[model samples]
Target chain A: GQQVMQIPQYQHVQEGEDFTTYCNSSTTLSNIQWYKQRPGGHPVFLIQLVKSGEVKKQKRLTFQFGEAKKNSSLHITATQTTDVGTYFCAGPLKSGYALNFGKGTSLLVTP
Target chain B: EAEVAQSPRYKITEKSQAVAFWCDPISGHATLYWYRQILGQGPELLVQFQDESVVDDSQLPKDRFSAERLKGVDSTLKIQPAELGDSAMYLCASSFGEDSVYGYTFGSGTRLTVV
Candidate 1:
């Protein structure tokens, strides 16, 4: 079975500090998608990385896919209070239409 | 923008009672999924449906749980004889395609608590 593992189960940082979460998969993935869920909300899609060694950015958030397609990272520059949420990385299973999600990294930004 | 829809945002029932939740996926999406998220945990896939046909349900507790996506548009998940451990958030998500590049849109989940 394929599994995605996320590092730093929890993180707390000042509003002006930067934060990063890493996701590693047991096997190479075809693609990876990132999502964010507020404290009591449904998960929302953020971004997806399909190409190996690819990088994408959305304002202060940066996402990267490793060349081997087995890991990914999300980095937030100068975190904000609105950035408080759980970040998840999901990958499709080899034989199904569903996805396997990482445990997620819960981010807490303090002002 | 289109969004997935779910009903009964919250539910509370006693143990051994039957409960159900409903979900309506975005139009034109081909894949629908049901996930369960325990408190402080990631969403775990319970079932996957490609239109009206179920693709996978290995993680679902078949002895007590069942799901259906009839007509390929709306879905329902039911639990019979629910236990306290069944308390969690049930999320429904839909994607346009099978590829991970096509991200899914999830509906506000149904939080269930079996007392």
Candidate 2:
């Protein structure tokens, strides 16, 4: 079974600082999706990366896909308290259509 | 924006009792999925449905867990003789297609606590 792995299980940063989380997969992925879940809330779609070596941005956040499509990263600039949440990276399973999610990186921003 | 809908935002049941959760995906979505998430952990796939037919349930504990989407519009998940370990958040999601490249819309989820 394919597995998605994420680094920095937890992160605490000061407001205005930067934060980054990395994700890796045991097998090549056709695409990678990122999600954010606030405390006591459901996961919400953030973005998706499909092309190798792809890089996409949304405001202060950046997403990158490895050339091999087995790794991805999300970086946030000037983190704010509103950025507090768990960030998850998911990939489609090799056997089926369901997505396999990483343990996720929980971000905490302090003033 | 369309959203997936789930019922009984929270549930508390005694060990060995039965519990059930319900979900209704966004209209016209063809793919639905059920996932379980323990506190401080990522969501794990429990089962997936393409229309009313189950596409996968390999990760589900069939001995105690059962799910159905009889009419292909709404779905239900049941746990019989729930154990303390069964306590977790059950999430339901829907997508416009079978491939997740289309992204997913998740419901609020049901938080189950087995005492």
- At residue B9, candidate 2 shows an lDDT of 96
Highest DockQ: which candidate?
1
TM-score for all models, in order of appearance: 0.97, 0.97
Model 1 misplacement above 4 A: none
Tens digit of lDDT per residue, candidate 1, span B46-85? 9999999999899999999999988999999999989999
Relative to the true structure, candidate 2 reaches a TM of: 0.97
- Chain A only: list TM-scores of all candidates: 0.96, 0.96
C-alpha positional error of residue B47 in candidate 1 after TM-score superposition, expressed in Å:
0.4
Q: Write the per-residue lDDT of candidate 1 for residues A1-111, one digit (tens) a residue.
A: 338999999999999999999999988888899999999998999998989999999999999999999999999999999999999999875745678999999999999
Output DockQ, candidate 1. Answer: 0.71
Give each candidate's fraction of reference contacts reproduced: 0.75, 0.67
